[model samples]
Each structure stands twice: as C-alpha cells, then as structure tokens.
Target: MLKKYILFFALIYILTGCGTDYMLSSFYLRKDFTWPTSPSEQKSLNYYKHVDGDLTKFNGYTSPSILATPANYLLVIYEIRDIPIYTKVYGVDGSSDMGVYVAISKNAETFSATPIRVGGIADDYGSPVSFVKGNRVVVLATGGIGFGNGKADEITKISVSISTNNGYNWTAWTNVIDTNIFKPLLAKANRFYTNPGNGTVLVNGTLVCMIDYKANGADTTPAGAAIIYSTDNGITWQLGSTLTYSGHRWARVIAERTDGKLLIAAVPNTTRNVDNIYNSNGALAWYMADSLNGNISSFQPSGLPNNSGGSIAGDRIQYSENGRSKSGILLLHSTPNRDYKNPGAGGATGKVKNAMSMSISSDEGQTWTLITNAIGQQEPYDKTSFRQSMKVLKDGSIVTCIEEGDKNVINDTSNQPFFIVYKRMGLSALSDGKYSYEGL
Candidate 1:
C-alpha cells in the first residue's frame, strides 16, 4: 500500500510539471512599468519616422500597406518609383498602370531598398498581400482590375509571385488559380496563411491559401464572398464549402494556427446601405474558422456576432501575445469606423475612419475576448489620419503605422505621399487591463 501511494504522488508531480503555466517563470519576467497614453509617452515610439528617407519621393511613398512575418521582418507593398504616376483620373493620365513593389525592413523602421517588381505584363499587379513561410516569401497580387481604363465587365485574375531569396528577387509570375472559376466577375483579394511545418495535428501538412471570390450574380454583396483553399503549396486549390457572410466584400488576411485552425479578417458590406458596387469599401468583420485536415468544419456565424460597430479593416494574427511562442495563434485586427452613410458628415457618402483594435483567444480560436479598443484618438473630422498596420515589437508593445490625415496630423504636402507621416503606439494602453509583463 505504501508503494502504491508513492507511485500516485509521483504521477501527480509529473502532471503538475505539464501544466500550461509550467514554464511561465522562465519565459516571462513580471515587471511594473507605467503604460504610455500617447505616442510621445512611450520611448519605443521614438522609432516612429526615425528613418531618414525622402518621404516626398516615390521611393518613400506613404500610405503603403504592410505585413510582418513570424521572423519579425516587415514587408511593405506599394507602387514603386512614382506614386503620382499610378493615380489615374477617369482613364486619362491617372498613373493607373503602376506595378506592385515590395520592400523589406528587419528593424521595422529603417527599411532597405531591395524593391522587387511582382508582375509580368505592364501594370498587372496592384493591392498585394504578402506572408512568409519557412524560407520562402510569398506574395499575392490582384491582377489588373483598377489599373488602366478597365471596365467592371473585365474579369480579374489572381496572380502569385514568390521570393526564396528573402525579398532579394522573385520568380516569374505564375497564375496559380484562375479567377474564372467563379465566372463572370472574378477579382483578386488580399492575405493568406500557412501552418508552421510539422507543428499542427489537424491540417495535413499542406500549404493552404484562402482566397476571396465574389459572385456578382449573388446580390453584389461583399459578404456573399466565398473562401478557397490550396493544398499543394498554392499549385492547386479547392474552394471551401462555406461563404463568409451574405455580402462579404473583402478579405484582408487569413492566418493558420498551430492547431490547424484558420482565422480570417474580412469586411462585410452591410454597414453602409450602399453596396460595394465598385469594391472600394474597407473591412468590417474578423471571421474565425476551425479546419480539420485542410477542410473547414466551422466558422463564425453570419454578421459576425463578436464584431462591434467598429469594422475590422485590415490585420494579422500572432501565436504568442509577446512573441515567445513558436506555435499557437492569437488574433490581431485593426478597427477603423463604420463607413455607413451619415448625412452632412462631409461628402454625399459616409466615410470610414481608421482606429486600432485587438482580440485574443487562448483555446486555438474557439472563443475570443475583446482585449483592446481603439488605441489612438478618434478622427471624427479628418479621415486620413489613422492606424494602418499592427506590428508586435520586441518589448511586447504593439507598434502600428500611424498615418497622417484622420485626427492626429495632416497628410504630407509633398506631391509624393509623405512616408515619414507614420507613427507607433504602445499596446498596453489599448489593452483593457493593466499592462502585464508576465508573458514577456
């Protein structure tokens, strides 16, 4: 009987060691630091606009969309060489044929000028979505829809380009999945994710690419969009059996968790009565999906019950809240305002403003908690000044690309969009609770 008791005690000890918080002491050190309110209150924000580049030049264009990889590298995609050259006005000389360009920055502030053009034909690439898996840098470009004098009758194809040399160079353009599968109206959308090699148990080690496809025959709603997944490293794809919502307009990003689940941040077109007739609306919903063996079993219900009035414009997901995890998944989304038609607000159409927000899930995305709200001030007056991208800093404070225009600052007067008109904010201020260093 004594031997049996001893064996039971040993088993208890082993179970305690396997608890989730078992390595908490070693991975995170608890510390007390006053959370900053504004950008100036935090020392980490000093890196904002610190890079000495010509913001007024096409080389350093502003308002470019950004994405960060698990390797802590920042990928910024924008029109290269000339910004004004791409801005077309009614099919005249509106700079519409500008090619998609990419730049890399290891430090998130000071970027290196290793620009790589991602399209073959003239002005074939625009509005790119990028992510990194293993040693490969994958980029998805929306084929010529908005460029040149193109009508809505034109069908847009989804083109893909990859960079194995870490943004140094790219392979020739390959039409991975022809957009014509949907028929009549096909457009290229944003964002894709893949699981870390050999980490997840559910997905069958296949590189999945979730794409946004609109069925124009189905009410012209963005929520009517459907998701498609690729199994063979984007070589072949199979459309998922589900639709995001009734009129889902845009899909900004799709992130796969360590447990083989997928999280997609999408925009539904229900907020404004005006349908996304021309596909110019921002995001409005952050949808989460649970996949088993590369097939989606369940997803967030229609209308996104958790999504508040704030629309999830564009965002990404991280495993560890502080960057300590090699696996697992945590959702990071940006919420600008709803662009529903508000009369006398400025123009005849109601405008959507930008604000930063976040959400977290501990159980591989089964349920989520709204951990943070808008980090920056409200831009009720100006629409341009707002947060664009969210970046997790080395110190755990979430850094975002704060552009001038909405409520903070004015857009750079230079003919070229001012690149330096960006800033960062601490994540703690955005968090609902006090800043906890336990996870850092």
Candidate 2:
C-alpha cells in the first residue's frame, strides 16, 4: 500500500513537470489564494507611487494615466479581470479586456475608491487619458487585438467618455472611431496586425489619437499604426495622409507648442531585437503634426539617444507655482531602460537599473533630460514600464503612472506581474530621486 501511494505521488510530480504552463497554472489556481487587503500600504514617501491601481492575489491592473485638474488629480486605469495569460499561467487583469476605470486623488498621494468604471466598449487595450477641455474633463481610451487580454474578435477602436465632475464620476465609453473606418487607409501594412494601442490627447486643444487593426486575431503578422486627429472636440476625426508608418509603437499626442507647432512622438517597430529590446539603432521619433490635419510632417528623432527607446510622450501639462521663472515647454514623459544584475549581490531579478525612469523636456519635444532614474524601476527583465501618462503639480513636482513587472514573460514563480504603479518625483531634489512636495 505504501508503494502504491509513492507511485501515485511520482506520477503527479511527472505530470506537473511535463505539463503545459496553462495546465500547471490551472492546477495552482485550484489551491487557496488570498487577495491583498490593499496594495497601497506603502510607507510615506514624498514621491507618489501606486494609487490603489495595484495587484492583489486575485486581480491585477495596468495602463495608468495621470491628469491634473483644478480640484484634484485623476488617475485612470484599465482593469483586467479573469487574470489571463502570463498572470494566469503564474497569474492579472486586462486593461484592454475591462472597459475603463478611474481613481481620484487630491494630492497624487492618497486615493479614493475605484470611482469610475465604464463598460461594454471594445478596444480598452490602449492607454486611457483625461484632459480638461472646457469645464468638464474628457477621457480618451483605446482597445485593440493581440493583447492576449481576452477580446474575442480582434477588437480595434478608440473611444471617448466625459467626466463632468473631475473624475469623481464618468460617462459610458462611446466608440469614436473603429477599425472599419481606418482600415481602408492602412492597406500598406496589408492590415494593422497586432496593432496594440499607445496614447491619446488634446494636442493644442485638438484631439489626436492612434488606432491599430489586424486582419486576423492577434496575428501581428504586419502590425500597423493608424493615426488620426480632430479639431472639433473629437466630434470628427481625420485619417492619415499616408499609411506607411503603421509600425510606430507608443504613438502619442504631444501638446500644442507655444509656437503653434503640434507634435507626435513614436518609435519605429523595426528598431528592436527579437527579444523586443531596442538594438543600437532604434530611435524615438517626434513628428510636427496638425491637430486638425493629420501627419503634417514625417517622424524624426529628437537628436537624443532615448536609451533603449521605450520613451512615451504626452502633452505639455502646465504647472504654475513657486517664484522661479522659466519660459520653456514643460514636457513630462515616461521612460524605460535595460535591466541588469546587481553589481554586488546579483539577485535573480537583479537591481532594476532604470525600468521606470522619468525625463523632462524644456525644449518642446526636441530633446529630453533624465530627472529621476530610480523611482519606478522594479524587478528584473524590466519590460513592465511603457506608454504611461504623467502630470506636473504647480510646485514643479510630478506624478507619473505606469505598470510594473519583471518581463512580459510568463512563469508561475516569475518575479513579474502586471500592476499599476504611480510614482511621484520632487522638483527640488531630482538628483536624489526623492518625492518632495515642498513648493506645491
């Protein structure tokens, strides 16, 4: 009888070792698991990080957008449920799968309960953004295919929802533009394959957005980026003049420059290695575009080596405080760099060299200067931070939103899992990478 029992145990071990990752993950799910009582239980730091959009034992979150309004700061996130794929195999949420969500914060530190969630809309895959148009705020979000976040049929569309009360509440997502409207213009890439979304904004008060559509399901065979712009408060959108650059990733709307110049920053897809890390030649391009007219100029490099080139661009969010006087663009961006082993202890995940670095551009998208290299970088494999949103306070402090993880890989015991992390960087001591709200 003891021999029989031993034989059964051995069989179980062999099956677990040889079985598919999904099967193994399913087995583990059958075990007892507990969701964290809360994830924002961090010690006080001047710089802000996660605002309740974090990972729990059961649910995970991703894609953070930070918008500063007169009353309070609004942090919007796309919630992923059913915790699929990488999160499933080990374990996470689909920012793209769930429609839309928002969490409000008065000072970018403490957050209210998940205040707003809009559903039934497709293409929740892209980053959702908020902006003050007139008295109300508008949220622009996208959903796409190939995210593996469980959108049944290659969902591709950009949607708009409005909040009259500064993110305390929100309206349902209304599909602004779908793949069918833009597919005709993107025949160049054959189709927008694996066209995962990036960002949206009110460029120079004109709405500009990006949408990717694929021929088949997550085929990503020839990924494409379809660009669009609107002048009439997103009532209508214009298609790109040419569909050649469908391969641009992290395509985003930079603010309307004081000089009346509209810009778009993006990186070409071919600049990276098979591992999805940028090779030596990868470049992040900023294009001078029109908010009303699309693709006013070709995308060009910012004359800077955006190290590893995962930098995403956003509008020149204004902040006026303190006695210091400077006349230039205050461009806030989210950046990422290569991961590395610890120089001393050399842990498996290694010290995140600079996964979630922050850069500021006083030169109107021409160049970027690193402000903090230590805030959001976490774990090893460090591919977690990308295409996030940022907002600056009146006192020169900043709040940025991003998803943290090790790599975009899947493993049960893997160190990385997708969760939204909001970091605060102080204006006074950027060198130390501390969050000091002294001036504000």
Find the candidate with the highest TM-score and give its number.
Answer: 2
TM-score of each: 0.56, 0.65
Question: Model 1 off-target regions past 4 Å?
Answer: 1-47, 50-73, 79-95, 113-116, 146-154, 179-210, 215-223, 230-238, 242-244, 252-259, 270-288, 292-353, 363-387, 391-440
Model 1: per-residue lDDT, tens digit, 278-356?
1133434455555522343335423123222212332223333454542323344444453433345554444334334
Question: Which consecutive 10 residues in model 1 have the weakest lDDT in total?
Answer: 192-201
Instruction: Tell me model 1's lDDT, rounded to 2 decimals.
Output: 0.42
Clashes of 2: 15
Best by lDDT: 2
Can you write out model 2's per-residue Cα lDDT over 246-357, one digit (the tens) per residue? Answer: 5555555555666665666665553323234322225565667653444457755353444333335453443222444333343444333444654345654433322555
The per-residue C-alpha lDDT of model 2 at residue 338 equals 44
Number of backbone collisions per candidate, in order? 19, 15
Supply candidate 1's per-residue lDDT for 128: 50
